[model samples]
Target: MTRVLALLLLLLALPLAACGNDDGEKETLTVFAAASLTTTFEQLEKQYEDDHPDVDVRLSFAGSSDLVAQITEGAEADVFASADDKNMAKLVEADLAAGDPAEFATNTLVIAVPPGNPAGVKTLADLARDDLQLVLCAPEVPCGNAARTVADGAGLTLEPVSEEQSVTDVLAKVESGEADAGLVYVTDVKGAGDKVEGIELPEAASAVNHYPLVVVEGSDHADLAQEWVDLVLGAEGQQVFADAGFGPPAS
Candidate 1:
């Protein structure tokens, strides 16, 4: 009859309406992170997605300095994770961060060489050699700042052939044999695996780098943003970072 047909149409419409409401219920969390954090954060993304099926996570990784610049320019991000304190301070200065940020992990500078060491470079002090070509991050970047600390600690002055915007670029130059030596984060070398070989430097003790994570202002999803921060500061997150060669944050 006509009444039976009307009931069937209403039942179909009810499911469609429920689906529309579910779309609005989705909480998307966006995080702007440092380039060195790429490998570790990938693991974090997977873990978080598995834990919160309804929440979606989007990540953008670059030089911490660049991320800060973008956030200051009013980019829409729910979280900001910096490779160092300097960039995190910038976010605070702009009032872009919600509150006092927390340090999640730490890293140190290392000398990265090509698989064959074509230039025969060695030692932190050897970086001052006139014949060696060096690629380093720009001084404004986190890796560059940490490199400066190691160089200063060793009383060695390095004249680099090129300054890259990100640590990944520095590692790429070394991996491709474009540069004889590169100063990059320890985590970068670990992530690169067979592409590059890393040499530990003792002076890095004086310049240990800290990674900080925070929720940015104007985020429509505050709870999810803070939850991501908690995840980063938690056991699984720390384990992933450590596996990538980063250390515990300084006390």
Candidate 2:
């Protein structure tokens, strides 16, 4: 009887261990993304978690150049999403990308000003006004590069008081009233909503930046990383990006 009871206890414990393995276990996927993708990626993270209960998606956002530097310096990232193709190309050139990077979306620069248009920034040319306290992304960043293109196309030479490392940083300066105006992505202006007013510039239309995504070459979670890439390129992910004001990826 004692041996039989012990055997029954062992059988019960086996089921409990199986339950733990099935329900309590999960894997984590680390993603490095551009600062401009913060809001949209956060939403997708939550959605992806809901769909894949056994996987956790962690996101780290910064300027695309900064992200590439981190990855090159041995950061353990499963995926990389760049705001522009230039940074993504850096990874590809280094053979750090697991596969061909796909263009997922496009964005354009817009002038973001404090609420109520306190600086009276009504146009792209207005960013040239010396009296306005302007902020911009540093030239190495995607938004900054796009801003430069827009400025050049419009024949405007801007003298911003501060050059931020990320587009989000530029938006923060405008939102906090530290700067009267900043050039950021149209998606960023939309994300900022009532915190800032967007000034549409026709010149910006000509300088759209393409966003790209790729799985890291050395990632241990290669299958999971590819799934993430598919998720972003799939219809659901495209809808989320579209709702955030991102344009369809170029053919």
Candidate 3:
């Protein structure tokens, strides 16, 4: 009778263990995105988790080129969203993209200065002043490349004190008063709230960057990845982006 009781106890313990495992198991969907998407994506991440109880949404944000490098080096990522087509093309050229990338938003450059505009910056031409310390993204970065395009179109040359790898870093320099001004996206300046003042650049219209989204070629959660893509392309996601100051996707 003691042996029979032991067998029943073991069977009961097995079922409990199985139940525990089921409760703890979750599917993870990792998304690698541009640094500029941080705020908007974080909001979406929360919504996605609330709606999909069984799936965990993880986000990694960085410069588009850096994210591409990570993906190419075999970092496990389900999706990729770039701030520009140039960086997105890198993944396509490597054949690391699962399908044709879809344009999700557009962004244009703006001059970000400290509150009160102490430097009295008013236009892209003001960034070229020798006395002002300007910060800008590196040439390889989308923001930096766009800055160059805008500067060229305006017939001016920019001499930034530092070239950052990401637009956020450039914005940081301006916000901290470490630099008199910086070139960043319109969305970034808007998102900065009162921390920085935005000066519109007419030249910016010429270098508008179209943001793109795609699923990584070898993603284990391809269906989940596509779902995330669909969410971003859907009306809800666009509204979130619009609220954050992102422009509509290029036509």
Off by over 4 Å in 2: 1-24
Clashing pairs in 3: none
Highest lDDT: which candidate? 3
Report the candidate with higher lDDT, 1 versus 3.
3
> Where is the poorest 10-residue window by lDDT in model 2?
19-28
- CA lDDT, every prediction? 0.91, 0.92, 0.93
Q: What is the TM-score of each candidate against the true structure?
A: 0.92, 0.91, 0.93
Candidate ranking under lDDT, highest first, comes to 3, 2, 1
Mind giving the per-residue lDDT tens digits that candidate 3 earns over 1-251?
A: 99999999999899899988877888999999999999999999988888887899999998899899989988999999999999999999999999999999999888899999998988777888989999999998899999999998888999999999899999999999999999999889999999999988888899999999999998999998998999999998999999999999985
For candidate 3, the per-residue lDDT at 9 reads 96
Preferred candidate (TM-score higher): 1 or 2: 1
Per-residue alpha-carbon lDDT of candidate 2 for residues 1-251, written as tens digits (9 for 90 to 100)? 99999999999899889988976678889999999999889999998889889998999999999999999999999999999989999999999999799999999888898889987888888889889899999899998888888888888898889899999999999999999999899899999879999988778888899999999998999998999999999999999999999999994
What clash pairs does model 2 have? none
| Candidate 1 lDDT by residue in tens digits, 169-227 | 99999999999999998888888889999888888888888889899988999989988
